[model samples]
Structure formats: structure tokens, C-alpha cells
Target: MVVRSLAAPPTPWSKNLVEPKIESSAFVHPFSNIIGDVTIGANVMVAPGTSIRADEGAPFYIGEGTNIQDGVVINGLEQGRVIGDDGKQYSVWIGKNTSITHMALIHGPAYVGDNCFIGFRSTVFNARIGHGCIVMMHALIQDVEVPAGKFVPSGAVITNQQQADRLPDVEADDREFARYIVGVNDALRAGYLCASDEACITSIRNELTSTSSSDSSNGSSRNISTSSMMTSPYLSQDTIAQVRNLLQQGYKIGTEHVDERKFRTGSWKSCTPITAKRESEVIAELEACMANHAGEYVRMFGIDPKGKRRVMEKIIQRPDGQQIAQPAATKENSFSGSYRSYQPSVATTSATSGQINQDTVAQVRHLIQQGFKIGTEHVDERRFRTGSWQSCTPISASSESQAISELEACMANHAGEYVRMFGIDPKGKRRVMETIIQRPGGNQIAAPSNSHRSSAFSQPQPAPTYNNKSSASSTRLQPEVVEQIRQLIAQGNRVSAEHVDQRRFRTGSWTSCGPVDSTSASAAIAAIESFLSEYEGEYVRLIGIDSNKRRILETIIQRP
Candidate 1:
């Protein structure tokens, strides 16, 4: 018996013990212990309070580029565990760049593959892990085989046995166990068990086998090997041709060439294996067929399919004749002129109806032909004129031509008016006004009246002159004197329009005034009083009143 040392002699304490022999830089904590027949890899960082012990019969191999973090304990038991190939015990294979984090325990007779992250405080016992797996924190993984690219979330307790066994009265069935094993094998080949735990694998295997056995008893032979059935010679040519093409494209045939363990138990095992002579003949036939039908194949299939079939087709058809073009119609019998109609189509009705008037249509056409925008206001005004009021539609060729004629006539009549209002050429002014009014805050500017001005007057007249300078001055002051008399008459006395007119005449200086009715006199009196109170004038007076002689006549008449 070969006896080996269980532990190495302790070295002087340091913050990290990274051996020169290891390719990776591992930061091993001073408090933790690592001993005996263990190899560490590149870029590995071991955190505080971690222990790695290899005391078993087999050596422990930690793969290239892995991290073992704080408080993790990795140990191998001395007892041998059997796996694959003739009951031999092999060394534990920890794959590249895996991270085993804090407080996780990995017991040996296990294998973990590359790029895996084992989460904190998880227990992995007797497991086979595949590449790119994430075993989350606080998960209890026992007696399981985890496949590639699997994620096990935190706090999950994964047990090897099925759920039925957890019941008190339930007994494990041998048939069920056999079924479970077969189902797991099926799942592995189908790639469905990539993230399977022990219980999941067991369940899948049991279900698959049970279903398969039932199908088998019904006389269905769906699981029979493809090659077991004799091939017809007729199909052999096509089959061989297809196989040859597939192989040329880098597809592998038969289980032996690829990983045999990754394949299903009976899948493609009995197919006639590719041989050098058969391969050559198939390739030669495919090439000949492709050459014969190259033109037709190119026409029928697009570039991609034609290229693919160029190396694939074993049988091909002859090319058809050249494509023919239809004959053109003679000028005398052409349908083009007959199809032309001035009336707009139903689709164009809204676009071409009263929404675009004959005048606007003419104007728009001219502008488009000249490569200019019809003035925005011209466009807007025309929209309103045509009863649509708001819309921006592209001018049609016919409509554009019509609009040009109408715009010319409109410009001839309104050019002077436009210049007077906008102080620019009518067209330029229209464009500027549209631009200004279309701006975000342009609504603040007063909008011009939509009503058109009459063309009767081209220029405004001068101010009118009065007959006499004093009469002109008196006329100006007449409104003020009438206003004063109107105020005097309104002291609780009802005054008529004639009496107000007489009082205005009595003040000869105010002769230019017009007669006022009772309603007018009352309103005028109120207005005058309000003006005097507001202005606080000192020289305000009522003129032309009767003196003491009128009082003597009134006293004599009272005695009689």
C-alpha cells in the first residue's frame, strides 16, 4: 500500500500564501488552513477564514483561474467513491474560473466545471457540476448532477429522492426508479436537463420511461432505429446526396464522431455510416446535377437558396426558354387618352373639390411650376375661400396650373392694396406675414380683417376747410356751451329737444350746434356734470338769462 502525508508542515504566518508554482494569484487568508496535494490556479482570491484539505486517496485538482472566498471549507474524505469506467476512483476535477464564495462546503467524490459561481453558505455533496452554472447562496444541493448553464436560486433545498417518498407511508418502487433513470437519460440528450437538480432529473426520467413503455406495449415502434429498416435503392441516391451535402456543411454523422454520451441511447446509431468511396460518389453526383440545372435553379430560387442548392442538388431539371415581353399598343389604339378625365376620382374628391377653388388651384400650380410656396396667407385665405379653412395638401399638376392664372388676376387687382397695408411687394408681403403669424407667439399681433377693401378709392382725401375762422372756433366751442345749458335745464325741470335747441340759439356764440331730444338733453346734462366734477373748473358759467323785469311781471299777475 502506498502511504502519503496527510498534511504539509505549517509555514510562517502571512496575510496570503500564494505559492510560486501556482499560475494564479490566490489570496489565502492567514486564519484559514490549506494543506496536502492541492493545486490552485490563476487569479484565485481566497478570502478570510477558509480551509481547503485534501486527505483522501485521490489528489484534488482546483482548475485554472478560480476564486475560493471567505469561510469556505473544501475537504475530501479518505473513503473511495466509484464513478464511471470500471469502478475506479479518479481525482476531483474542479473546472476553470469557478468562484466558490463564503461559508460554502464542497465535499469530494464531486466534480465542478468551468465558469461556475457557487453562492455563499451552500452545501454541495457528491455532485457533478457542469460549465457556466450558478449555485445561489444558502441552497442545499445533495447527491445531484447539475448540468451546464444552470442557475439554482438561494435557499432552495434540493433532495435526490422524489416527492412521493417524503410521505410517511410511501415505499420506493424499483420500477419507478428504473423509469426515472431512463427519463433522465432522455432529458440529457434533449438538452432539457441543462439546469436539472437530483429531484427534477428523477421526476423527468420516471415520466418519460412510463410514457415510452405504454407506447411500446401498444405495438408502436416509434423508438426503433432509423437504419434498422432496409433502405430502398431509389431513395439511396437522394439520401446519399443529402448526407453528402450536410457533411460538406460541417454537420457530423453517427454518435461516435461527436460525444457519444451526449447522444440519445438509440439515436442515429444504426444509420449507414459515411465511407470514403460513398462520400466521393455522392459529392460527384451532386456537383453534376447542380451544374446541369444551374440556370433554372438560379431563377427559381433566390441567391442564397441557389448557392446552397449548388452544392446540394443530386437531381436537376433542364432550364426553360427565355422570358418574353408583352407587345406595346399602337398609337391609334392606345387607351391612355380614353382614361383621362377632368373629374376628380372619389379618393381625390376631398382633395380636389370646393376645398381647392378654381382661383387657388390656378395660383398654386403657377407657384409649384416656378418652384415657390404660395404665400402662407394666400394659402390660408384660399383655404377659407374654398370653404375648407385649414389643411395643407400638395398641389396637383392640373390644380397648380389653374391656381397660377387665378393668382395673376388677383395680384393685378390687389397689388396696390397689399402694398399700402403691408409696405412690400404683394407676394413678398404675403410670405412675410405668413412667416410672422406662423411663429409661436405671433398670435399677439393684431390680425388683419378678412373683409376685402373696395378698389374704388386709390388715395385718401385732405382735411375739409371751414367758411369763417371765428365761426370755426365757435363751432368747436358750441358743444361746450350746449353742454352747460343742458346742465342748467336739468335742475328738476323736464326739457324738450326744441327747448334745448332754442337755448343753444340764445347763446349766439354756440349757433353751429344740432338739436337734441329730451333723452339726448338728459344724457348730455349728466355727461357735463360728470366732466365738471372730474375737472374742477373755476370759470364755468351759464349765459343769456332774463333780469329783474321778469320778476315784476310775475308779481303783478299773482295779485290779479
Candidate 2:
């Protein structure tokens, strides 16, 4: 029952008596407070203003090679307070090579596993910290159970109990302190403390021993409710199996198995019922077992080993919850094919049927026989069969002779019409006639004659002469000659003639006059001039005709 008062004078001599089992070879600041039942392991360094207190009830234990930076406070409160056993007390357990940074407070009833990092100003309280966890700066932790290897980010506030709906008024410094504590706890649960399994186990065992002592010293009754009791972390394997079997039988895990006498006392409805405590303990034990077999469970269940076990419990609730097996196929052979249905319709008859041309058919047959496929080489076979060879057949030697003769006749008529229309042969008449002959349906013509020799011979005959002056001037030309003149102009040609035969040919309109003369040459010139004056709008300029021939040209250029 050694009790030390907070107000007691500092004793320098006690330092000699309480020599460290493994003292830090490095400098430790004089202002820092290091007190009671603490074991600072070898090669550890303690910075200035760092306070470490392992009190009489709960001692503080640090593993080898750990560093305590400036402004760090490592302490342990009463132990054995959680569990009922009186012999053991709570302890602060830190793993090997862990670093506790500036202004970090590590107070227990809390367990920290190995190789964890407690960042600046982290706070921890009554939490089970896992190995290899990281607690960043300014974090708050309270009454939480953190698993191993998690990273608690900076400024995180983790609280196990639900806070009041309305927050209590608190100073900034107090809030800051609370955050630090939470941060430390978070680091512990996240497994930043210990790097290895051995270190983790050692930290947990030390914490358990220390907590046991605190529980005994306080003389607090172990009043675990049935729910809590069943969930205890120390349940036997046989007990866990029993719970599992009961769960399989549809008995809820947390339900009370109350004796009638106990029920009369209204304990069944109590907030912390005895049945609940037992059930809680059982649950805890089951969880621990599952945690131990977590790797195996994850492999079987396809879940993370360190994940929450509620999901695992649900999965295990049904007996046949394991992966279902697929059935094998029984039939050995199968056949598949595509099928289509069709319907027939009545045909219609043609109104006017024509015979296919034997000549054209023979030509097509020859083409086909010469390795030309019907559908591939030619198009519109039905039309080709009925029409004249000129309509559908390609030009052959036989077709060419007929075509040439037809073309020659067409050219002759065109030439004759053109000369008669313009009163002279037109320029480029031969080319224009050739073009007309070459057009798709324009190839056919009457047989060529000796008159079709050359352009010189194709010129129009001379016009008949007229004598009376006034009568000649008033005479109207034949309409056929006028039409011929129109055709000649349209054929892109020049026309010229000898005499003005008004009785034989007439200038239809006398809108304008030309030079009058009685001689054959003069009358021809006068007639040409008169024609030009009447239809000057037809040819604005004569390209090839000279000024001497202008009078004759003008008459020829007149519009019909």
C-alpha cells in the first residue's frame, strides 16, 4: 500500500536506489520527470522535458531502443480495474524501437504494440493499441480497440462511447489535449507500436498483468452483464463451439437463458444484465478465436482477416453457408442448326410481249461464248433482247458499217440543211456533224453518196435572181430555205451566197435595209447586207470575214 502524494518534495537520493535496469547512455534533461517502477530498456534516449511515471499501482514498461522525445509523458493509471483478478495491475507497455515524439502523452490502462510511431501531441487513453500502427499529430483516442498496422491520420478524433448531443464547453488547450490522447490511442490500435508478433504479444501480456492488479486494488466487483460476459476475450474453445451450435439452432447470441427465479428480480431487463455480460464474454472469446484464425477464415470466406467479424458471424450463422458446388452436365451430345420458313405468291402476266432479236441474241451468245458471263458482262438483258441492235448492242463491224452509212446520211442532211438555212456553209460544220453522228442514238443514217465527198461540194446552190426593184425588195423567200439557214447557224457555221432572189427567196422582215444594187454581184452584196441589217443581233462580229465581204456577211448573219 505504498502511496506517494503529488505534493511531496523531490528526492534526488531516490534516483540512486531506483537505478534503471538498462539506462540510456545518451543525455536525459534534468527538468523532465521520470518516476516509479519504470523499466527504460537499453540504448534508449530520453529528450528534455520528457516525463515518465510508472506509479505504484501500474508500472510503465518500454522495450529496447525506444526514444522518448521532448515533452512526452508516459504514465500508467490503476491496473486490474477492468478484469476482477486482484493480483495484477495495469501497465504501460511500449514495444521495441518505437518513437514517441514531442508532447505525446501515453497514459494507461492503454496497451501499445511494437514499433509504433506516436506523432507530436498525440493522446491515448484506455485503448488496446495494435502493433505497427501510426498515430499522426494532434489525434484523439479514447476507449477504442484498434487493430494492427493501421494508419490514423493527423487530427483524427476517435471515440468509443457516443458523445453528448450538445458538446460541453471546453478550452482550446483542453480540446487539444483530448485530441492528443485520442491520437495516441489510435496509433496503438493501428499497430504502429510493435513491428512483430512477439512484441505485440509481450505488450498485451504486460498490459493484462497491470490491468489485473488495478482491478484488485480498487476492490470493484466484476459485475459483467451476460451479454458482455459471453463476449469475453478469454472463453475456451469448447465454450465457443457451444455458442456456435446454439447460434446454428436459431438461438440469438445475446438472448438471456434466464432461470425463472432470476427473472422475477427484473434482471432480465436490466441495462447490464448478468446474461448479457456472459454473452458478451462469449462473443469476445469467439472473436479472439476467429482473429487468431483470421488468415484461414479470410481464405475460406474471401474477406480480409483483419476486417470486422460481424460479417463473418453472419456468414457462419447458416450451416451450409460455405461456397456452393456446381453440378456436372449429364447430356453428352447436342445439335444446333439455323432454319428459315418461306411463303409463295402468284405470278403476273405481261401485256405486250416482243420477240428477241436473233442478231442481238447471236451477238450476246458470242460474247458469252467468249468467256463473258451474261449477268457480269452486260446489263438489262431483257431490254437488249427486244430492241434494235442500235438500242442495246455494242458497236461491231456489222453495226459500224450500218452506223457509218447512217451517220453519213445524217451529216449530209445536216450539212445541206445548215447551208440552206444560213445561205452558206457554216464554220466547224464538219466537226459539229461528226459530234451529232457520234451521239448514242444519232449513229444511224442513210447510205453515204458521192455528194458527201468534201466540204467544197457540200456548199448550197446559188439563189435565183430577181429584176423589179420594189418587187424584189418586197419578195418573201421560201420558208424551207429559211429553215435551212436557221439550221446552218445553229451548227456553228458561216453562210455566204451570190444573188438576192426575192421572188425565189424572201427576207421575211424588212426592218432594216442594206446597199441596193442591180448587178449580180451588187444584188448579192445588197441581199447579204439586207440580211445582216435585219439580224445584226445574231452575229455581233464576224471573226474571219474582211470589210470587203462585210456586206455579204451581214446578209448571211441575219436572224431567220
Candidate 3:
């Protein structure tokens, strides 16, 4: 439904009444508002929230079979009138079969020619739009002349003659875009005309049934019955033809993915896939198209699908024109883990890296908490080392020290643990970190001076203190338990009682497994490998109990 956004000014403007001349056949929807000296031709559809006012200047003329779609605002500016071939004076002239889509603002003296599309939220002020031209969404044309069949990219702003001159020539004179718009409008008009016609709806349904039955019996291709075509008082033969052509082009025509058991053996049937309606599926289809068949895919799924394809195509390509391989499992939230486990390793590494005099370990831990990629090879590549010298700020140490510290952290942590903390492998956590730390430098980072290395590890260290708690009440976390937590944390996940199930980890229940710290960490960790071994190529979740008294779910773990 259309809603008016403006009210009349308190200061009086001219109240002279000039009734709008709208054709009886045209549909000026209840939500659209038409004011003084406006002339709408036959079969035009003035959709919801459209405001066409010719109050201050020459009359506005909308030609036949045009569509003024939702939220279009057409205003007449005070300018010298242009005389048409028919000797009529005009300020704003929209030609036949044109489509002015949602939220576009056209201010006259502007001339929009036949079969043109004024895309979503685009603006045309004192401009000339030639036939079959496309003014894409959010584009602006101010006092400029767009030649016929031209394509204007989204967000393009053409203001002057020089700017207009620089515009590339229209790609093709085929007018495919124009035809598609007209076809869509024609379908809308036909549907609107048929919605209230009970007899017509019944006839169409019968026709569809008969057509399907006949196709099944005769083994013939599907076709619509001519007699049951959408042709009411509101829809002419041209409109029907346009709708039929659109259907033939496969725009939202209802069909199914029929599984013909006799023809194919696969679980999924070899048939036309159902149309994707959800936003996610649309995005997926667009992505698939970009990676494979762009042109054909865009043509099939048309709602600005090609724009995303183009963007992704560019993103996945190197400057040298080679395609970049997408990272298999790099995105944050791909896994999760606890942060407390990696604290000591990070501290020890910092101590070895000559940052023992400062709280570099705390800084690194803070970076991980703040989402930095300190775990992987990206560390050497310097992913987090940019921007202001904050948490990701470079440690004041030699490259050798940094490499050794990063390597120690990677080995001490579980796979995917770095990603959970930092979202990337900053130091090539597995392979590169191992290689770089061993390389020659001033002094080996592994061997910190005796004075600084003294506190790196303590023999029979006391249980971690919290709020001045006593050692009797606080139990020291086992190395295995800490390692388990590290593994879970690296995977970017957390253990909770809610995720426990009968599937994989095979521990009957949290109560049956006894306390979290009671079990050997090796056995619990081994259960993951054992589960995968027992399942043998099948996917399963490895469940276990964490020290926090919650269940841990290692999802869909498939071992090679």
C-alpha cells in the first residue's frame, strides 16, 4: 500500500485546480497520487506510492502501455516546454512500453523514451533518456543525454555534457533489457486482470491440468493452451504475448524437479532444479554461476544476480588475471575453543623471544582475545601487524625471536586452534613456523638467557590462583586436560551439556563419564581417533566431558 510522505506547506502555494487526464483503461492504483495537468495514456499501470504532479510547469505526458512502478515520483520543473512531433507541449514525457521501477525520481523537463528502464532509486533531473536505455539502481542523470540502448552502471552520476560524452556507446541494439522489463509488466498486468475473474482462474487451472495430462500421455513437450491464455478486458493480445514469451524464457514459471526413476539412477533426480526463492539460495546460485557459468546463470536467476557474480569474479582473480584459490576453512566461527589453555605457551614464547622484561605474552593474549591471526604463517606474513600500534603491534624483538615464539605456540596448540583465536594462520602455524624458527639468527630464540628463562616453567607448579583461593580447594589442571581445551578452542567451539548425544564420543552420559578432570586427557583425545576408526570413513561427532562439567562435541569428525 502506498503512503504519502509530504503534507502541504503552511504558506499557501497556488491552489488552481487542473484535473489529471487518466485513460479509463489505465490503472492508477489507489495508493498512487496524480495531481494537476498530468496525462496518462491507455493501459498504463501507475503502481503504489507513485506521485505524478504537473503543478508548476508544462503538462506531463505518460505514453500508452508504460509502467510507472511503485514509489516513483515524477515532478515537473519550471522550464521552457519542448514541442513534440504531434505539436503538443511537454515538460515531462515518458514514452510507450517504458518501465519506471521502484523509488525512481524523474524531474522534468525530462524526456524518457519508449522501452526504457529507470531502475530502483535512480534519479533523472532535467535529463533525456533515449529508447531502450538502462538507468541502473541508484544512478543519477542530471541535465545529461543518454543515447538510445545505453547501459548506465549502478551508482554512476552523469552531470554534464563532457561526462555524457565519455560514456561508452550502447553495447547492442537488441533491446533485450527493454523487452524483459516490458514482458514483466505485461505479466503483472495480466495477473492483476485475472485475479478477480473467478471464471478465468477456473479456466486457466483446467487448461494447466489438461496440458499436463496430455504431455504425460503423448510423451510430448509441455505447452500452454491458447484458448485458456490470460486475455481479459484488461489484458490485450500484445500483453498476453509478452507474458507468454516471459514464461518461455523461464521467469518464475511454476515447475518441479521430477524424478523419473526409469531415466536416472542417482538419489537426486536428473531434472530442472527448483527455482531458488530464499536469499541464501540466491546468493549460492550467484556464487556457483560466478565460479562456473556466469552468463547463463544470471539469465536464469534474474534479481541483480550478475552484479554479485561480477564482484566475486573480480575478488577471486589476481591482478595478473590468474584465479585465486579460496581458503578451504579460514572464516571465523568455522571453529571455536577456550582461550585459557594457550596462555602459558604464549607467555613462555614471549619470554624466549626477549620480551621477558615486558608483558608481551599478555599483549599477545589480548590480541587473540581482540581477534588477531597470531596462530598461523600469517604472523610472519604480518596480517595483524598493520594499523596503530595497539594489541597487534609488533613486539620489539628480532625476527628470529618472533619466529621461534610463534612456532612454539603453534605446536603447543591444537589444529584449527589458531583460527579460533586469530581467524588466520599468521605464522604458517604448522609447516612454516617450524622451518622459520630453525633458521639462523643472532641467537636461538629457544635458548633464553638463564635469568629471563627462570620463570618460564616451575617444577610442581601450584594450582592456578583465582581471587586468592587456597590450593586445597583449587585443583591443578592436568596437562592433558589443558591440551584438550586447547584443541577445542582452536576449532573455534565451546563445550556445553546441551550438545551431548548418543552418536560418537560413545561416553554414555556426563554422569556416567564421572568428573571432567578424572579421565585421562590422552584417552579422551584418543576417543576421537578411535571413534573415527570404528566408523571407518563415516562422519560422526566425538563427545566428551570438559572440566567445566559440560559436554564437548567434536562435530562430524572424519579421519583419513
Best by TM-score: 3
Candidate with better TM-score, 2 vs 3 = 3
**What TM-score against the true fold does each predicted structure earn?**
0.26, 0.26, 0.38
Candidate models: Cα lDDT each: 0.37, 0.38, 0.45
Q: Give one digit per residue, the lDDT tens place, for model 3 in 155-214.
A: 566776655654544433225445656656666766766765798888999999999888
Model 2, span 259-295: residue lDDT tens: 2233212122211211222444546533443454332
Best of the candidates, lDDT: 3
lDDT of 2: 0.38
Q: Candidate 3, after superposition: displacement of residue 407 in Å?
A: 38
RMSD (Cα, Å) for all candidates, in order, is 38.9, 45.9, 23.3
Clashing residue pairs in all predictions, respectively, total: 14, 96, 25
lDDT value, residue 155 of candidate 1: 50
Candidate 3 residue 475 Cα shift, in angstroms, is: 56
